[model samples]
Target: MATGDEFPLPGSTYRGPAPHFARFRAEQPVVRVPATGGGHAWLVTRYDDVRAVLNDVRFSRAASYAPDAPRFPGLFQAPPGMIISLDPPDHTRLRTLVAQAFSVERIEGMRPRVAQLVDELLDRADSEAVTAPVDLLGRFTFPLALTVIAELLGVPSEDQERFSVWIRQFAAVDGPEDEAIAAREQLGEYMAGLVVGKTAEPGDDVLSALVRARIGEDRLDVGELIGLGYTLLGAGGDSTACQLASSVVTLLARERDTWVRLGEHPEEVPAAVEELLRWVNLPTNDTSGLPRITVEDVEIGGVTIPAGDAVFVSITSANRDEAVFGSPDELDFARGGEHLAFGHGIHQCLGAPLARIELVLALRELTRRFPAARLAVAEQELRWQPADMNHRLLELPIDLHGKGF
Candidate 1:
């Protein structure tokens, strides 16, 4: 069995590629690792193997609730009716209701608004004038993400600061175990209250839609409603926040040719955003050892994952697998849509549409406005949260053209 010390969690520290993950993927694509909560699990890293485990019904997501199921102590548990934690039938039904809210057409409708938000942020960045030091993570990515998600959920604009505070505490990577638990409960209560208010006066927001919708008299209860809110905050906010910052930083770090090329072809923003998603691969550690207990024996990559065993899928490694992606480490905007940043199978990220819209708008606007932008600081001097879960930069001091775009 691999000891807890053998495999470092995704975001533990940034020392090039994760040593444990690299080693494990090389020697053993699937191996047992000591669970954070207890027992052990089989961590799957290869591209094909990870996809198989994700799509396999014999591997149950609901198994996380089993009496002896192993899981991280403070990780948020999906309430009943929340699609993330459910398997078939119920999962299919619950997901369908929210699916329309994130459809291609619905997300496309938000493009102009998303572009406006991006323009506003970039305008602020330019207002500072000169090559002023700015925290892209805080000033640009976080606000943009928070604003979009708040609007989508119909959260009051004035209350966003409060919502942000709750999210910070709720998603803190390092905290006392009890503190994380307390934060979760407090955030849940807050969401519960918000849901109640939305129910009383239904609005045109996603939350209201969820509250008013029904499936044969079955609807989201308070807990599940709050859980959905939490999911949006985490997925809809944090993931995009990190990715936006990382994309900006990565783009500027490259030759001026890349920025010029992108700016010249703004229509390629969608493809560029796809490349960014694959390249940055945030939330790598977010799915840490979130094992799906096997309902029956299964063979993957020639290895047998026995029944009742916990199977962990590593999204980060899978995206970089040599067998699947050519020159896997290189970033190519034209690589098309072969990556698994949104995951695979039924449980793929529901917020993917929103995330794509955010990235496309942000990147297009940034490049168009600050075509000459370049990193003012050395790559080695940049700071990041000490984990693979968030691909973010604490600050992105840049020198841009004096004239704002």
Candidate 2:
């Protein structure tokens, strides 16, 4: 490795980006590492470089699938019809058509229902904790995230259990590559049937909204629609579930004062959620972010990455950049500032608005309703999934009743 950094670079995951990333940001902001297939890929860690890579059109997301592209070998690219794979005009068109469903009005209108769901989940947790440690991931975060996205996408309740399984399979890094690919296909197939049904009988939901969406003579084909639907479920649902659950774990374990204080002033919950998003390091198996293939020789952080190379931009590191955040590693809810938690540029998360709403509402409710909540077990005792995949506590056991043993 050009930086002498091994894969899964060494660092404590306690606060953010681990310690090694901070060193890379200072010493080798842009360094090369062994690529998955066979070649080398540049790792961009500085906030400025990370943003530059994201904003520069020369770094192409679509090119990542080229047979000869330098990339991590397994699952080198998103399936063709997925939005994450598209670059400019194609990405622009699809996003325009679908963006209406995630608009401010639509997402805000969902607040009441989201609040209701959160309360219901916490109700279960509160009751169950009277007897035993309640698995907060299962009881609160997972279902709230999955249910909201499912209803938004107009997936029938009967079909949603399968949706969760498919998403988990797709998100698992330890699982066989073939199984993950199969899960993607199955999810796509399921979404194909959903589009047909929604097309025939429109519902007041995102998929139906997309079904009716058009541009002049342009409309999304079945493949594009299926791809978008599954993308929302897989990326939106699974990642949000992971982030929200992990945020909760951080609060109960690390920032118990902030956790209790936020409950006292529910209005501060949104700001607190923002800090958590910036602070929590979503554990992954790689030293890379989503890979973008260089369309031309690009200079980021004073390093020249040649054309046809894969560039891995670290959003985690960028969010923790010292130049951008004062005392960058410390989780300061009061220090409101821009961060790359949702990423940057056109490829930024489309479901970000909905996710913010979900996180804000869920946290607000939890803090208010169960202000005495505490971890039932030591932080190390929390069962995290294999580090090969995204690190998420498999189950978060909490004492929701304020009675800690």
Candidate 3:
């Protein structure tokens, strides 16, 4: 059995790629751990094991509602209609309703707009007289993602900045519990008000579409509606922003030859995005044990996980399992798309198409405009968040080509 000491402290910042995950993958793919009190939980690391747990009906998402569920108590409270926190048939029904607004076809149609937004952001950044030390996280990635999500949800552009603050506060790594709770309440209230407005006057956005969609009588509880709004705003904006910023940083940190190869061959951009997604697995760990519950005693790779115990699946470790990925730690664009970054099975990220579109357009535009752009600071000197949940650069200072396109 493992203990808290056996896992890298959950919130500790890993500066570069995590070496510990590789070590764990080698020694213990499915490890049992002591949870609060005398209880035990399993931590599954291998690709096959993780995928199995994700799809297994016995291991339910409704585990979050268990009376004695051990979770990061302050971070998330189980909310209904949140596809991430529910089990079937509620999960199935909620996902089906929301799925209409998040379809791949709908997301694909927005690619042209995404491209235009990318070009405009780069053009504006280039126009600034002092551009060398601009933080990509702030200037390009965050704003671009925020704009996209805001427009998709029909959120008033004027209200974006205000809501953005609530998001940051709610997700802050080092906030007091009271502060975090306050932020969540504020965000809920704001979203509730917005839903009321949408009800009165429908718009051609996701929120209005959801408000008008028919499921059952109680398809969307009031809390669920507000929670969905908050979830979309936070998840859509934050994840894409981190990915966009990290892609640039990772590309520059690699050998100049690789950057040149990608820049010259635009066809490689999709492959590059996949490689980036594989390499940059930075979602918050599921200490909640909400997704997996042992209905019957199960043995994974010879490790016994007792029935009724909690389990945490490590996607980061799964993505780097040597058996599944050759040269797992190394970035290889030629490698086929097999990474679990968007997860596997029914629980895969709903925003994946949008994320891909944003990434492809951002990378293609940035490289085409500044073929010679390189990192102005050493990797060790770059500032990263203390939270291990995200691999982000606080600042990405780069030297742009003097002659702009």
Candidate 4:
């Protein structure tokens, strides 16, 4: 396989994923490339090849996290006990323990609460917008995502503001290395305390459940508990927050008809949300969804990746694969099929159900409230978060345009 551009590439909020992803998907499904952080590894762009890599056990997440593992230059290493760094059956065991909290029943149970939160947030947006355009990323999306996850995890509502600061730094892709490290350490310490508090005064929230959750005879140790907290904050809060902001921007600014369509047919909002998730490629620099290392020689897309090689699967590109979704770049809610936005296989996003609920509710309410919402600033003038693996808007400044009613 030929080598492509350096991984991580440069962070560009104004632009989307590298155009080379399309070219590579059309030509070389798999190729090696210099990692943005430092080292070089295989970059897989095709939808089929990416799905194969994610589903294949030969491509090991554990090996990718090994101390002696090949790394993508400057990427932050996963701390011990973080579930994302673990391999099965450890991963399976840990996932099983927390899976109940995110079960279909539990997430479904959250709909009313989530909708209420969205309504309150939009109310606040309206109040704030009386003077000027409100930045939804801060005023609505970030708070909504973080608050929901915090409430689920038993984090104090008052502390969410503080937690958000640390999480943003920790999740930033272009932030200083020292600041990120500091943020992680600080957040870890905070989670440790939070877990202990929950253990002592166990509540009805997810973290309390996790603190006491068991898989037969085993339970999460303190380290694992802390790690899980970290995961939830970063994954549930950070990623989903970005997704929410991007969804609003994409729907309102780029796909206004889709927005109008959903507003007209509220029943189709769920399917529309899925399509938006697939089509909106926030500014991303992480070529791979998360770097995986080949446990052995594995052939993907006719190219063999030997054991110990870091492989990055381009999910953004896969979601846009022309083979799977004709006219891949277009956002057609009616044109739906399986997409890898939430990934596939064992490590598929654990919070997908919650994210879907949040997005659906947010879209339903936003369309109901502000069908005419439009960007207050030019699309080109908007800035994006320089986050690693995150494609978040720095702020979604928008005018509500006097609400839908």
Candidate 5:
């Protein structure tokens, strides 16, 4: 394919994967292409193939960090405690320390509080929406996600805004690299202080739990502790904000009946969230999925990627692969299939349970409040952030007076 065009396979925020992936799935399921980070890398698109690359131990996430290793620019995850960058023993060791907090039971227990927060935010929006429409991205989705993560991590109320500000800057794909670096350092410094505080007097939060956590006699040192905290806070907050916002836009603009039906029957929300996860493809990777190097030759989608070559498996393309998913582009709530939205294998998102809870509860509650909601402005007025990494809608001016969008 001569490293066709550039990489990342261009995608749309509102629409799913660009037409490119479908063609890639049908034709060259595995082909070499130029990556965003300045190198030719293999792009793997079919369903089973993408799943294979994700699960196969031969595809090394850890080794891709070597200076000479070929990789696409993804999460600038080059820190001591970044679990996504680690493999096997190290990843397993760190993940165990904080695993309990996001257990399904723990997250489900947070439902009442999540519902309460949603309602409170809605109440404030209701009062404020006398004439003007509310920016749901700002007022509802972002706040709902930020507050849930902040409270779970025990970020004090006063410091949350600062934490949020730094997080937004750090997560912004559109921002200057230097600014993101500065914000990253700021977040680390703040989290370091928080870790110190947690050590002195622990609280009933994830950070404090980590403060007391130990693997036998070994404990996370200050740098690793800060790194883990940074990873969780950055990932848990902004990613959810972008995803939930994108999902809400999907419901309001595209799937009105599903929205109304869910509003009337909140119990169905849990099931629907799975389909939503499958349907809304965000981190369709602005660069690509933390490129993995093949430890040995890997036969994926019929292509034998030689050992030590960087490969990117497109989850977005896989989720919509017609072979695995019938009528892949159509958003069917009744669809029955496991989707790789949270990813697959050992590295699936640790926060999947919490993300599902937020999506389910937020949508369930939101529909009840604004069943008639539709776009406040014409569809053209809706703006999505430029393609950097994930699909993100910038501002959704939702008219809550009658219905909502």
Candidate 6:
């Protein structure tokens, strides 16, 4: 087995996609690599092969969490039966129930609020602009994403900070395992109480709506409700924040022209947003996207993956596949094409609509207000966490005064 540990995989130290991903794509697109837990599994790096693993019904995400299932190192296993850990039927049911809150109408109605929130956040960042090099991740993007999800879920403002802290620990890949588990439990307990309270005095928020949402006379139970909350906040908040921050970082560092185009022609922001989503390498290069297991023998790129073998799909590499993308590394909004940043098939991200709205609005406003914004520190000096969950920067020190707002 070629462990590939000799390669520089993205984690804390390496900031971009590991060079090995491209090499693997060329030499061995689908090969067995060491699993994080303790065994060998297939690592699919090519674009088409990744889509196969993601869309094929034979590959089971739910089974990947089985007691005897295999997991890659440092990959956190979601509690069994969690919405993200389920396959059809159960996943279908939960997704349907949760869809009420994130419907197109509901998210579209949030545009004004989203814009308002962006303005408020930028106002704060501008005030701190007196102290050049504001930490965009800590001060803006992270909080903005968390706050949006919190408000959407009807979490009280007073509780959002504490709630976000618990979530950070729970979702963190590098944190202590016990603490992350405890944080998850605490969040579940807190959400349960909140649900009960909302049941008594329902408000105009997602949680309140969730408390009332049903599926053929089957309402969400406390456990399912808590699990839903975890899925929403975890998936919707942390990952989106990291993605938003990385988009900005990548644009400032490598796609300055694209960033300028958005600033000059805000009308193009929507189209530009999609390209940004496709371009930014989530978690790390060759995203350790959601892990799935093969239920039956499956072959991809001429490699046979045995049943029960963990198959890790690299979205980062897929987005850059040379066959699908011309000049794959370049960030060109004109290079419009579908990319699987949101995980391809049935389990595609539920919060994708809202995430797109946030990213588009964020980039639009940031560019309009500070057209001259650039990295305060050199590109190579920027720090990145080494994990496969979301490509996140430790800090984004940026000069917010591009041509003096």
Q: Is candidate 1 or candidate 3 better by TM-score?
A: 3
lDDT of 1 by residue, 95-180 (tens): 87667456677677888888898888878877874546555666788999999998888888898887887776667656555666
Question: In each prediction, how many residue pairs overlap at the backbone (N, C-alpha, C within less than 3 A)?
Answer: 2, 0, 0, 8, 5, 8
The local lDDT score (0 to 100) that residue 40 gets in candidate 5 is 81
Q: Give per-model TM-scores.
A: 0.89, 0.95, 0.90, 0.94, 0.93, 0.93
Question: Residue 301 error for model 2, in Å?
Answer: 1.4
Worst 10 residues of 4 by lDDT: 8-17
The prediction achieving the highest TM-score against the true structure is 2
Residues 74-170 of candidate 3 have per-residue lDDT tens digits of 2334354467777778778877888877767778888998999998888887776254555567778998998998888888889989777777777
Candidate 1, 254: how far from true, in Å?
3.4
Q: Report per-prediction Cα RMSD to one decimal.
A: 3.2, 2.0, 3.2, 2.5, 2.2, 2.5
Off by over 4 Å in 3: 1-17, 34-40, 73-81, 129-131, 216-218, 284-291, 402-405
lDDT by residue for model 6 over 1-405, one digit each (tens)? 334572125332223467777778888898776544457767788889888877787889888867898655566557776777888888888888888767789888888999999999999999999867799998889889899988887888999998888987887777888998899889988989988988899998888888889877988788887888888888888888888888788778877787787899999988888887777766642555567889998888898888888777887788878989998877778788888878877778888999999999999999888878989988888887655356678898998875221
Task: Please tell me which model should have the higher lDDT, number 2 or number 5.
Answer: 2
Count of clashes in candidate 2: 0
- Stretches off by above 4 angstroms in model 2 are 1-5, 8-14, 74-77, 283-288
Per-residue lDDT tens digits of candidate 4, residues 283-319? 3653445678888899999988888898888788888
Q: What residue pairs are clashing in model 2?
A: none
What clash count does candidate 6 reach? 8
Candidate 1: residue 351 lDDT (0-100): 85
Query: For candidate 6, what is the lDDT?
Result: 0.79
Report residue 395 deviation for candidate 4 (angstroms). Answer: 1.4
Clashing pairs for model 5 are 286-389, 372-403, 373-403, 373-404, 374-404
